[model samples]
Target: MGRIGKTAAAALLVLALSACTGGTPDPASSPGPTAAPPATGAAPAAATDPAGQVSGEAVSLETGTDVGNGRPASSHDGLMVRRRMVIAVHPTPDADLGALRRQLDRVAAERGVLLSDISPDVLDPVVLEHVVPEVIVALPPEGTHEEADALAGLAFGPVGSFTGVEHVHVGSVLVHDLQFRIGSADPAALAETIASEGILSDALGNYSTSLDGGALTVGYTGPLLSDELVEAVREGMARGAGVGPGEVELAPRSATGEGVDLSAEPEPAETEGAHASGRDDSGH
Candidate 1:
């Protein structure tokens, strides 16, 4: 019996060893579960282009109304072209303020423009707001007719803000950088010839200048300026000479002649007074 018991014990011991050694797995040999699938659809990183701003569309002046002769103007999308001019006027030889006023009066009568001679100190901010001229010709500096035309181009911006004004037109004419590129014989032809030689580099940008007998025609590459403003400037130029619309020309910075010179006109009386008072023309 002792032998039988011993034998049975030995068998049981063998079975225990087999179960421990053969049935259990080797963890090192077993493959691990796959990592969670890579996170899906990660967003792309932001990038920037070297050149911003797509090419801007050209503004068309042909579609709007004419505001020539102060007939009223129109509005436009922000894309409207705005031109501005500033001129300086100097006192005529004697430093006479009254003569300045008289000159302005005469100019106003002939050009149908309003003129006001406010005291230099009295030209307060409020009055300035009310008296925002399309062209602010500073007296005591003087300017020329060409300068006036450039100012006329810039005046379009101010007039564009007026209600009932449609399209684009020049608001004021500055007499700065005013050069008389006047031609003889056929006024229009002369104007055209001069414009052909100098308009691109002198007048507005990319605008073409032409002549039709005595009439001067100006065209831009893109669209017309403010209907009112452009017409105003054209008519203002035409008042002395004939001005009209021409073809649209393309080519940047094509206009020449450096800018206008408003100082070409006579200066105001206050200018001399300011200069005499040791204030230089700047203070008055």
Candidate 2:
């Protein structure tokens, strides 16, 4: 090619490059979307197994660190055990949860809902007060109905012992608060599908439901309700909702009775060497 022709071609190329580069975004300015807020349920995708053991929910409950331990249990065993109930308490309009908690404690004390009954692991009695004020009470497995009666009385009876409580939700396998974009599918329908259409299986009638704003949370109360089973239901719900795996933003699965924290599962001790020194396991 001639020198003048080559220079003109190079100039054209530079102009084309400049046009293409005009819309190039700065990496620092354009960041990827952050992960969804952590799930409170905290269970494996495969934990939907029907264990026939209703132990209640295990909460990977994450709340603010400001509010202190609400009358924690005396022993460490309390922290390790399963949650008997996830009683979500709704307070009166503009009421302070901290103050409501204090009032609930006093009322519970008076009603004989012992501090030990409520799981100490879940900030004791009141699990979540910041966003959704909730309470936890136990109807002991071996303990008589009288004890259960006492808990029910403290929460519901005596005509408002714990004042300022506007609403209450009782569940075992708590689906954590969820996040839904403006265009996200409605999860509220999942409850109707699960309840009316037979999704609970053996754990049916053992679970409870709670609706906070746009989020619908289902928790199990029966000891047979396992975290594995909860995950199954969630997956089923997603399928029913006509959404893909990650499309429907269901919260993490946590149960009351017995739960195997899939995230915290221990590695097999007998893994030996992942790869023998300098030796590839894959056939070359």
Candidate 3:
């Protein structure tokens, strides 16, 4: 009613990872509807928040199993205190690739949120099958569930206006990611610490960081990332010489950072080609 449910949002991550065609998306294309599988009481109840928008009940699922070996990782295996989610956008006919990217970039930057723009490329076959996305904003994790939801909602609040790139409501999927503010630490140095301490591995950990100005911007990774692995990395950063509680702060950007021009026709800015803030999933 209000928006898609949280569970459905998480479900979309699984759908995207599995349904990816690894080919470039056709902006004018759309996926044909799949008949909704019959619902059963046995099936999990529909996700309440930002969910139920999807037509059918999801009966079966697959995850970090065939992708790798060893104990399987469960998406709901833990509480999502830290979080990441994907916002899929269905563009209006007038929407151009660059316009969509700028719309999301300006809006997200205004909120100090980093974005990964999967435009003219990714097509989440399972959920947003009606319209091709001009941009999909990958929101990084906020330290707490309430915080994460608040940030996500705020970033997505200006969906169909402001910049004038209207995105018809499609679907938003919450992916797996655990993030912490690693204040003032050199990302490269902390990365080395994570490596030396064995915080990351092909098995379960991750080593991803981003920079804004000269400081390490909060990094995000998930769905495939392990909680234990991410936990170790957070600890490594927080335990540093003067680090304290590693929490997330959804603050706006400083004055030095470029501001978004909300007027429909904004003057040109730097190239966000396919990623906002010159950052992407790799934590550039």
lDDT top scorer: 3
Off by over 4 Å in 3: 1-82, 92-94, 116-125, 131-134, 143-166, 170-172, 178-284
lDDT of 2 by residue, 1-284 (tens): 12111222111100000000001122343211111123232231110112333223221121111111222111212212232333444456665766655544664565545432232123211222222334434433233322332333343332223355543333332112122211123545666765566664432233456655565555432222233433455565556566653543433233233432322422212212412321111110
Clash count per candidate: 78, 24, 11
Q: What are the runs in model 1 whose C-alpha is more than 4 Å off?
A: 1-185, 189-203, 212-215, 242-284
Model 1: lDDT of residue 226: 35
Query: Tens-digit lDDT track for model 1 on 153-213?
Result: 2222121222222221111221111112222246665554444554333323333455654
Worst 10 residues of 1 by lDDT: 13-22
Alpha-carbon local distance difference test for all models: 0.26, 0.32, 0.34
Question: Considering lDDT, where higher is better, how would the candidates rank from best to worst?
Answer: 3, 2, 1
TM-score of 2: 0.28
Q: Against the hidden true structure, what lDDT does model 1 obtain?
A: 0.26
Deviation from native of the Cα of residue 87 in model 1, angstroms = 34
* Candidate 3 lDDT tens digits, 12-46: 22322211111122333332112111222132222
Q: Could you tell me every candidate's TM-score relative to the true structure? A: 0.18, 0.28, 0.32
Ranking of all candidate structures by their TM-score, best first: 3, 2, 1
